[model samples]
Target: MRALLRHALTEQGFAVEQADDGVSALEWLEGNDVDVVITDINMPRLDGFGLIERLRAGGRHRDRPILVLTTESSDEKKARARSAGATGWIVKPFDAEKLSAAVRRVAH
Candidate 1:
């Protein structure tokens, strides 16, 4: 999923940076300014929900677009993500085109 998202974003002219876990993601965000962030729900160190909460608490990334991509398809999970300030949600096994479209819509 990460590879697909990276490929899709790169193909659309985005220079992508990757992190294996939420801790690294937050660390990267400290020094970098990203147009958008796409993350999975379940990850080590800190989960996607925690990442969003932290981002929202921060200054620069609070209002930045955040898209949650995960295999979790439950309505409850989606609602939770929305409440956490996620811009959008994409279920796993997603089509690259669809994911790109969602990213473009939210990033703008």
Candidate 2:
């Protein structure tokens, strides 16, 4: 999924960075800046909701866009993520064009 997103986003002229999981994502963000964040709900070390909460708690990432992309579609989970500060949600399997468009919309 990371490779696919990287290819698609890079093809659309967006610089793409990836992490193995929430832990890695947080580590990467500690030293870099990005316009958008797309995370899956089932990641290891820290799930999407946890990741979103941590990001929201940080001043540097609080106002950034975060889009949840995952197969989990339960309303309970959706509400949980929203409360955790996710800007949007996308269910898999995703379309490259639509995902790219979403990234474009929130990148600014």
Which one is best on TM-score? Answer: 2
Candidate 1 residues lying further than 4 Å off, grouped into runs, are: none
Candidate with best lDDT: 2
* Model 2 lDDT per residue over 1-108, tens place: 788888988998998889999999999998888999999999999999999999999768889999999999999999999999999999999899999999999987
Ten-residue stretch with the least lDDT total in model 2: 1-10
Task: Go through the candidates in order and give the clash count of each.
Answer: 0, 0
Report how far off residue 72 is in candidate 1 (Å).
0.2
Instruction: Summing lDDT over every window of 10 consecutive residues in candidate 1, give the lowest-scoring window.
Output: 1-10
lDDT (C-alpha, whole model) for all candidates:
0.90, 0.93
Poorly placed runs, candidate 2 (over 4 Å) = none
lDDT of 1: 0.90
Provide the TM-score for each candidate, comma-separated: 0.94, 0.96
Cα error of candidate 1 at position 95, Å: 0.9
